[model samples]
Target chain A: MDIAILADAVERGERRAVARAITLVESARPEHRVQATELLETLARTGREAIRIGLSGTPGVGKSTFIESFGLMLVAQGLRVAVLAVDPSSKRTGGSILGDKTRMERLSRSPDAFIRPSPSQSHLGGVARRTREAVALCEAAGFDVVLIETVGVGQSETVVAELSDVFLLLLAPAGGDELQGVKRGIMEAADIILVNKADGDLKATAMRTCADYAGALRLLRRRPQDPDGFPKAMTVSALEISGLDRAWAEIRDLVDWRRAQGHWHARRAEQARHWFEEEVRQTLLAQLAQPKARSLMQSLSEQVADGQLTASRAAQDLFASLWPEMEQTKLPESLDATIDTP
Target chain B: MDIAILADAVERGERRAVARAITLVESARPEHRVQATELLETLARTGREAIRIGLSGTPGVGKSTFIESFGLMLVAQGLRVAVLAVDPSSKRTGGSILGDKTRMERLSRSPDAFIRPSPSQSHLGGVARRTREAVALCEAAGFDVVLIETVGVGQSETVVAELSDVFLLLLAPAGGDELQGVKRGIMEAADIILVNKADGDLKATAMRTCADYAGALRLLRRRPQDPDGFPKAMTVSALEISGLDRAWAEIRDLVDWRRAQGHWHARRAEQARHWFEEEVRQTLLAQLAQPKARSLMQSLSEQVADGQLTASRAAQDLFASLWPEMEQTKLPESLDATIDTP
Candidate 1:
């Protein structure tokens, strides 16, 4: 619990300290939250950073396989690797993506690699928020590369991208129609698209899919953040491990290009600003997410859904219900109450 | 200022009252906002409802022309109609979509039709939120149909979809690749895709484009909220005033189907719930959007951006600054401050 000692241990890359710090960040207890903030603030002074890569894939697209192979490869090169999964839908699916570290057995066993499952079991927004903190913890612990993996559920992939310097999309070999299923926001967010399972029978199919996306990417006017021939699509095979080296090389090239263009620092700063703003917004919303106010919202929403009350009227009533709570706060008198106490 | 009188006037379909109510909703003054909430709540009791059709098209796609023609046609049918524009990009573009009444002069002058431009010039979120209230005002004023038009900017169209009973997408004659330029989120949010400018030499090309999108729609699995043939694509010539009848008929058919399937009420209830929750969240965020808190956030964000402070550290400091403000409120002491004074 000693902030300085824990930060020093994290800087020395002590695995226990790293795990404990991550656990601290994940805790929802008020006192723990205070300590977590203190710990993070202390570690921030260390100024350590890692290549934060965000990886997203469709369900059953071999995401775990990809991360395992990818993490192992990084660790083998004498780089400490951390794999963190962010699955906001885990509670509903009853299958946490990284719940069984055995999925990444080899990587988990690697002394140079660290693996963690999704932080919160539910609350779509909080899972990704907590994962962002975990990524910072990994960076402070001296990891050379941190792979943040997320399934294409809700907005997890987009949230993961905010925590990452590089965003990678892993897709299975599919036709154009399947490509249409991919949300364009995520496609535009990707720095690189990898058509995975590109070996054996599906090799040619994966190549064709890659070509389709590559062509699509080519048609996209160059984003100011990226260089030419960048944001390109390629095929990869996690089982055969054939295309990873090239993919890694391409990632390095993109990172190097970005750094040379001074975009690396600018981008990190922008991401930092984004997260700070997001933290502020999320804190505000969390007030309403608390048990008392949530029940009131639910009851009022039921009235709305039943046509017993209009949405506006229900909203006004709820807003009025929280006035007493707002009165005691130094909030501007103009502040409108939202979360209602039971 | 009189909530009951205004609600009564609105229900009577008085144009002056409708416009005044909308302006009240748009005003950010504390007193005006309180009055607006009261008026909306009173109006909600009337239970008057209108079909809200969301319309979206790329700039230069003749959206205004389409709306004008479409609005005139409905007016000709003796149906009372209201046209509301939600343009979040108005400030930057310096050209609000419905700013010039001359753009839809004929429709505007029609006794049965009313047109109002975008409410907020900037602040993307507030524009659409205010427009939702405006739509409610229109509905309470006994308009049979309300057309919500938005340019393809940010998430305006998506927001419009939530406020609409049926969502329409208007597009110029273009190839399959151009379709790729359309965000898939908007594409899927659409109920019908109309290939505008389907007259003149572009007729055949429009038909081809229509066929291409129709084919794509066919490839998509049917959304449960829609019928089998719905969300299909077709060609329409807004200039020629042709195809408007068919489009209206298709919309009625879709509405009738959804109504019979029980999805219509369910959808509205869900939208109400969504808006209610959004109001709560937006209220919380509004606290920071105030002058003092916002300036603090800006300065701290600059620090984070300049790398003079880590994002977490800056966020922590900002959070700390907001605490004294929080202590005055009955807010659960759980809220860490997130905004600071200069």
Candidate 2:
């Protein structure tokens, strides 16, 4: 693999090269991981930037329709769009129903549009890592916009929101007051709430739902990073393609405002730092899963469960076993000595 | 310390010994920690079982009043009670308003009651570990009921709930519709929702609030482990010392039902397992904070923030450096080998 050639091809907007880059990053092999890292490093200096948007909705919320409509709109305005779906649930089933191109036939045919489904075999953390790397690849491939879509199940939406500049939550208009259906954590992470199916006979219901959400948002604690210090709510009919432009405009305004306030850059930096810490934690956990440590941990866990050993003491014993040198060193002064009454 | 003597003293209901046991567990000193573990192991087989309950509410929700009133009721029923307040916020300020014995003057003065404030120096994890150990100590000291109190300010409440058999969420009646003020995560964790201060002119409001919460709970997903598969809601006036018996009855019923269904024991086992894993992770994180790993981590973090290196790659590099033998060994088969595209 010629690193320079691959980087050049990706930067030149070669579709096959871009897909290959994503596949390489998503691979679980150690050597491929090393090469993927080198490729990312090589392309880091290219300075290609993309607007990252996160889209989420419950199963029946028509997330695919909205993405296709909104994505096509962006393409019509000459913006290159890439859609990356992160479906962690598919990891267990080893099949992703989300990435079928037939679901968005028109958008799939557009030369300016690229849609990639989530990797079916990876865990949520692994999928998130791949999605983030794919975003970088898309940017390097000259895509002006990257849409990260996720089902509003489990913590996948939260993970998607973390890597995105803007988070859009889609909801149906019926039974809008049933806010309990929406996890408050997801609501808090949302920057914009869009009431889908606002056209046709659902218009009145959609209006009421919009008002309901607006009231609810007012009662919620304000997000410090939001430009207005609160999330915005609006009604949009993705079927009719109505209000899509306004939604896009709102997203743009927020991006500009946050960028001007220096929050955008700061948030990205914070996210990067957070990802680094997560990687370190995950790697350490994986190391602890080795046979030697795993067996010790299992026995220790059993003792702790049976109340025969304290978890902290067991942890210390395990750590000492893993790194014997730590046991010989004097304990740090921060550890209170007076407590040893003997 | 004489582990056998201390364990015997704790089992004999000696308040001073119980307090000393708690102090030993809370100490960070290496020798004290080791001794504390031995003391705990010695006391582990005493078969002292206490009814553990977690109580949480927002500021001004009358948590102290409720607990004081409720604790007195339990004491009147010839039950010994131990109150462990976990206020992580107080750790930073080196003061705990929640555990002020003055706030529960009557209960604190009772020989049947024990109240321990939050430890002022440790982080939330440390405090939680100490509190858990203290719970065991209190049980050994013949306290038949343990009340774990925490402010619903952050993830601290979640930690408290995890260690308790039943979680009670208290809320004021005034903001009934403003469910946004109450995080859904906490609401979902609650086994019983109490509308505190439901007397005098606020009786009607409290009733309405109780109804609202019941409806909200219906809309929320049921916790799988709950025997009835849903949390219950009620109105209580701590100031008037009314409804405390009914609340206790509700808690007893839930505990009995969960025990009969075998979920109670299973949950405790799961919690113990979780604690062991948490301890392992926390200890490893502490190791990473040591000077050798700290400097390298700092440099890697800077590189990650600057986008000069990806987090995954940096983590791999750090792990390899920390365990040089890993570099020499062939990558595990679980780590796919096919990703080396070259």
Best by DockQ: 2
Fill in the DockQ of model 2: 0.35
Task: Point out where model 2 deviates above 4 Å.
Answer: A1-5, A91-99, A174-193, A203-236, A245-263, A323-337, A340-342, B1-5, B92-99, B171-188, B191-195, B203-237, B245-264, B323-342
Candidate 1 chain B has its poorest 10 consecutive residues by lDDT at B333-342
Angstrom error of the Cα, residue A321, model 2: value is 3.6
Clashing pairs in 1: A328-B328, A328-B329, A329-B328, A329-B329, B319-B337, B319-B338
Candidate that scores best on TM-score: 2
Candidate 1 residue runs with Cα over 4 Å from true position: A1-9, A59-66, A92-100, A169-261, A303-316, A323-342, B1-12, B42-46, B60-62, B92-99, B171-183, B192-237, B250-263, B302-320, B323-342
Please, what are the lDDT tens digits per residue for candidate 2 over residues A207-248? 999888888788888676887745989999999999999999
Q: Write the per-residue lDDT of candidate 1 for residues A103-178, one digit (tens) a residue.
A: 8888888999988876545452566557878888898888999999988788888888888889999999997788
Clashing pairs in 2: none
Assess candidate 1 and give its lDDT.
0.80
Candidate 2: lDDT over CA atoms? 0.81
TM-score of 1: 0.82
Error in Å for residue B283 of model 2: 1.9
